[model samples]
Target: MAYPTLRDWLFSVKTFAAAMLALYIGLAFELPRPYWAMATVYIVSNPFVGATRSKALYRALGTALGAAAAVLLVPPFVESPYLFSVIVALWTGTLLYLAVSDRTARSYVFMLAAYTMPIIALPSVMNPAGVFDLAISRTEEITLGIVCASIVGSSLFPSRLAPTIIERTDAWFRDAAFYATETLSGRIAGSAISGARQRLASTINGLELLLSQLAYDHTRPDVLARAHELRGRMQLLLPIMSSLADPLIALYNSGRQSWPEGLEALLADVIKWFNEPLPAVSEGYHPDASADALRERIAAMRPPAAALASWDGALLSNALWRMKQVVDVWQDCRSLRIIITREEGSWRPHFRHWRLGGTQRFYDRGIMLFATVSAGLAVVLACSLWISSGWNDGASAVTLAAVACCFFAALDEPAPMVFRFFLATGISVLVAGVYLFAVLPHVHDFPMLVILFAAPFILVGTLIPRPQFNMATVLVAVNTATFISIQDAYDANFLTFMNANLAGLAGLLYAYLWTRVTRPFGAELAASRLLRSSWADVALTASTLPIEDPRNLAARMLDRLMQLIPRLAATDDHRHPSIESFRDLRIGFNALDLRRLTGKLGGEAPAAIAHVLDGVRTYYESCVNRRKREPVPESLMRSIDAAVARVISQGLANAAAPTATSPTSARQLRDALHALIGLRLSLFPATLTSPTPPEPETAA
Candidate 1:
């Protein structure tokens, strides 16, 4: 085990202090369950100030909402225990579905609300008239604990998430740069690239939680905007970088001797540019002279009109075009990072032409719904047993089952995690049992209680900051606090303690078994669903007539790719799916770009482009229907080549007679040519032969 750092020790000290403060206050206020106040401290405490505060707010709101729900519902259904259990189960499930769907820190509110109803209401079912008071008291105690945690966490040696975000952003950019450089220089290994891409996607996806916490970080609006802008550019960069691999690999496979003169020089220069460091944020952000220079070199190296009609020329042109995009996006990322990290600045965005997608994510509703329902059923099962057996402490069992269910509803396989919870809670019961029977009864006063609690609580709090130990330590700490049942005065009963703790164990065991039985498929189902969703999206994009922004399509595909990565890793089906997702992302971009470019191309070009798109739609639709990858038809290849030939020929014709073509018309023709070339490359990387160009005289 790694030794704890000073920061971990500090966090532990602060957390222990907060817990004690909450306990002392609860005792002074004469709360019914003073230990509950102490337990709440651990539940909401985080190493970072902003995260702690955010959780505190969510926990407070969820607690109030849940308390209100219990106050209103428990009285009406108290006389009908079976019907009440059913009602509670539905409430938990419905809220859990929303919580799981959100996929954000905000989901905590719904999750807490889901389980909190059972925690408060089920215990008061026998005393219907007292439910309201019970709810109020529980809310007050929990809110007090939250307030104590927030104050202690934020006010003492507060750790801000903003700096961590900036640090992570730097690391992400460096890794992406390394991947891009390796790919461009033709030295990247397949496995290396795969792992790099997965890490980049995971980092980008993981930032959502930290970014969500930024609002509570006292971050400036401009800084927040810069952070988000940097994220969007990073998303934009992934597919472009991945797309560059195909054309470059194709060119490399054709042999170094076939490379155009100065092509390697140009590639070296671009790689050098990526390796160069930018000016620091304190120096104030300036334009990246290197990115501009690299783009100019790339533009100068664009194939001549005659060469554009050849297979090698198109491949070279597409690769250079994508390289230029990577440079532009990288420069934008640098500017945003500098701005975000700057201590103070008045900054203007350097890149605003692209309309990036919003925060809408791809949630597997079917799987999430199934998981939520399973969680609800676990609650129902626990309740039925409790009601049937007339167990006096059965309320704790039902409450814990609901808590266990809500804790990991968002995971692909929550069975293992639930099992961990069982073990942690079991350990906690033993520890709490010892303290209740052997230790606490010997303590007569608050300071003495604090002295006794210090060693264990502080030790466990230190482990909370380390991710591997976080969940287990949290369960142990919180459950131990709850189990000890510290009231306004000393009251320790051996039988009462065992009954409640055993019931909790029973609830957790049921949850574990229920999850294992219901979710045996694990990540495979979710991974397949994400893949199918992307296929469906591609099919829809290809068939739709109205122009869609390629950026939005890129955003959705990239986001889907991010979500799919971890699941793919878990299933050990990584390589093939990663390739397909990247290919689909590139295809979606090319398809959308083609649709937009269609409005600019005239004559046979639009007809040819429509043919290619129709084929794309058909191919993807077949994949979706078969629930497997369908082989691309030779007809699609023919159509893509036809579209490329038409666009290139028209573009050449326009260039040959400058007087006949407006600047706008020439630019449009060029864009269409590039899009068609990209589509051809994406669909047929192996096909090297280009169609015959039209005769110059016939073009004129």
Candidate 2:
């Protein structure tokens, strides 16, 4: 355990102050459950000002919405507790689905609303006539806490989120750079490359979450724009670099001893450039001119149209072209970084290949539905037991169950997390018991209360910022505060306290058991689902006509890849086929390229390309049906080769009649050749064993 730094201490202090302020305000108003106000502070307080403010806003909105729901829901079904319990369970499940679907901080709203209704409504069931007042009081206390947290967090030594975002972005760039150089230099392959890529993808996924919260960070418009633009470019870089690995591996695997003339020099130069440190943030600086110089070298190395007829030339062309794209994206990333850091620059957005208007992500409705439904069932079972036993404090159990379920619904396996919550709640009960019976009895003054609370709250507050301990610390701090039920006058009823706190423990125990039974499989299940989803996506991309926007398709596929990469690391399930996500991504891109170029390629070429698409679609469909990995059939290879030969023949003819071939036609032919070659390389890298040495025309 690393010692708490100054920043962590500051966060702890600010959060504790916010909680006390909220408590004082709640006492001044004499609202029931004023400690709820204090609990809410720890629930939403983030180290960063913007995150705290954003959570405050969302928590308030969700609280009001839930309180209103309880008011509307409780009175009508108050006499029918069983029906009411069912309704509440359904509401929790349905909303939990929405919460888990969104993989961002914004998901907090739905999650809060999911459990908040139960928290408010379940307690009000015993006193139906006072439901409205109860709802109002709950909302008022929570809102009071939210207001205090937002004010204290933002006003006192606010930590800006932009610098953190910049730091994360720089770290992402470094990992990507390392992966790129390693792949380019032929130092890593197989599992090594897979591990490295997984780590990179994981970081990119994290950066996406941080970027989603950027708007709440008080970030300048230009920097925000640059950040979004850079995100798209960074996503594009994955495929570009990933695709580059294929042809490099193919070149080496084809019994080749060395790179084509100038190709080795070019690869070394590009690697060197990727490793070069970015210039310090300064005014009026630009990176494009330097990027252009390297791009020019790449352009010079491209094989002529006549040379593309051979497999070696096509592979060489694809490799060099992808390298150029990598350079372009890297340069743009650097430019965006400089501007984001300096917060001032004349640099315009340079990378526009992908026009991702807004973030597009992948969601698995099946898994989400299963997870949420299980949570709802848990709530129903808990409520049934509570109603049958006539336990008034059982409302706490049901409410905690719902809250715990919603909190962890997004995890692949939430049982262990729920178990931790169970343990944390147990700890909180013990601590709150000591404070209630032993310590708070002598605390007759508010200042004394503050001093007594300081020891535990401040200590737990530091742990809240660390990821591993975040959930448990937040629970302990928030639960302990509410469990003590601190008010204007110290009211410690031993029976009421034990019943309530124990019911909470029981609720968490139910949640853990239910989650364990429901989600027995861990990351392996999620990983399998993601891989199957990729195969389905590949099949759809291949078969679709008027092909989807390449940028949009790329974004969705890349997003899915990033999500899958981490799960792959976590699970040891070898049930998955010997397929690389990058290979799948490359295949998808190649299919889209061929679909787009079908119109541009006149003659027999379009028909041959269509055949390849049909074969790709069929193969993936079979994989989906058989529920196993299928080998790349030789027929698909024939189709791809036939398509390539036709495209090359057509292109050579066009070149023969220079006046008849427009620049656009020439470019289209080159694109078709590159896509076909990339497709073949991705599918059958090992089969192409013949090392046809590069000819002079294509070598340099």
Candidate 3:
């Protein structure tokens, strides 16, 4: 048997209570006929409909404004059904446009107006005199519903947004620490590091979103300011985190004897400082005496200890340099403790890729709008058909509106959700109608109805917090309850509701299938392109250098390599076949990092290689700072070309086994070698150049 989570229990109790309250209001007041429609106002008032409070408020306001507009216009235009339809269509279109264009406060206002047209206007066509009364009644019911839902939602197992923000912040910090440790250990190579960086960026973006949601809750400004300060500190930590790969790889390859003395102790201190509460004094004191002792032990071993006896002096120096950077990061963290504590102000909008702009955004918006309008139309058609017939005691207009709200609100993902909405709406309508017509006629007690409604709500609510099938099941109960409660009595409309729902399900299924067919191969192609691009960059960076440059070109190259790390991580799918290829690309980048460090220290004769490495590092550093994949420097490219030519020339002349070989064979060998070098060069052009056609081997 599956266990119920905290969310499940909360949702069950709240939903049941809301349903009971709606019933009481309808029964006690002896409201006019179409009690089902009034009850729908309560159902549509769910907070989840809008996700955020502001959006929900906007949606409510839109509903009210649109309802009022419908009442005012219906008296004059209700006689002409065609005119009313046109007015509703125009209003809906305008509202949708506002929703799309104005993402802030005004967006929801427009959307509410757009959606109100069919619900309020279409129902008043038969009895124009009743339009004003119906609109007023709906406004009252909806307002009451919103108040009740909000009160219950807030009091009953409310998940406070602030705590979520703090948790995400802590998670991001943990991931960052893990990434740093892995980079230093040499366990994560080039592409993997890139992937890690990408993950870090995404986590940061999520944190930003959380902070934004929290900020909207009318919290104190001081708390919000503190969150902002903490976020700034984290942002400052990004570059330092990216730069640790070089020292880490150097330490990993230095052999045991070449390892920095007390390096492990320093690492432990860094982790402790990050994980533990801040020390009282930021600068020269340690809260834990043992941590101080460890630092002292490491400092004593620093210049030369047992660990360094067999190691080269240069490697030791590089290790110390990297360790000092880590120490500096810890010191910054300690100083920013206050900022981290003030968890309120960190909220900001999420970072969306500017590259995802232009046509793609427009298309997504269009799909959402189409889904919403179609859903509204479906609801209106169902209600109109039911009313036109003499079956007056069946489902009401309000019931249809409630269904529309739930279905259309989920237009965020139109394809998959369309069918789910249809199924939910159809089933709810049938169950409610059947209970009223066949079951309710025999049972006169309110207690039975409460129990009957409670059973389904409890079952669905309890199942809703699970990971996979929660949504589908919860919708079933919610839609059913809404349908049952609103209508005064159920008359037979089972087949009509079922067929309409089936049509909705079909629309959603078609959209889902169509999207898959149109977007096939995007993931694999994206991964391949990213992999090839990163590889070409690594190769080009490795081949170039500026002679006599003092800046450690290896460090620069490592920085360049870090830029690709995130891209590689983003392209990963645990099940993809090309994952192995991605792994190879990562290893190749790490190898380049290693080669760069060795070249810098070995001080070999090809001074041009050193200069090119420096240029590569510079370009990489620039790219990181700007958060973009910039062109490789021209100076670096020319130097790489010259070095490749020189290497090829030397290899040809120094062919050791000068056997009696055919001239054609020699020519072919020379051409192949040159082509290989040229291909590498073409991979990392310093400008906007078309990608070279892949050779058969690379393509394979």
RMSD of each: 2.6, 3.0, 13.6
What is the lDDT for 105 in model 1? 81
The better-scoring model by lDDT among 1 and 3 is 1
Superior by TM-score: candidate 1 or candidate 3:
1
In TM-score terms, candidate 2 sits at 0.95
- Please identify model 2 stretches exceeding 4 Å from their true place: 188-192, 254-258, 282-284, 349-359, 544-551, 570-579, 688-700
- Find the 10 residues in a row with the least total lDDT in model 3: 353-362
Quantify all predictions' global Cα lDDT against the true fold. Answer: 0.82, 0.82, 0.48
Where does candidate 2 clash, by residue pair?
none
Q: What are the TM-scores, per candidate, against the unseen true structure?
A: 0.95, 0.95, 0.56
The local lDDT score (0 to 100) that residue 313 gets in candidate 3 is 34
Encode model 2's per-residue lDDT on 1-700: one tens digit a residue.
8999899999999999999999998998899889999999999999988788788888988888878889999989988989999999999998888888877778778888899999989998878888899889999999999999988988999998888887777788788878888889764455655566677777777876677677788998878888877777777787788678778766666545545678877888888888888887654675567678888888898888887876667888888888887887888888888878888876655455533453568887899899999999999999999999999899999999999889888899999999999999999999999999999989888988999899889999999999999999999999899889987887789988988888999999989999988899898888888888888878877895554466666668778887887786522222223236668878887887787788877878888889889999899888888876688898887777778778888788888999987999888888888888888877776644553332322211
Please provide, for model 1 over 492-523, each residue's C-alpha lDDT reduced to its tens digit, 9 standing for 90 to 100: 88887888899989989988888899888878
lDDT of 3 by residue, 416-468 (tens): 54456556656766676677567767765677777766776666666654537
Model 3: number of backbone collisions? 23
- RMSD (CA, angstroms), candidate 1: 2.6
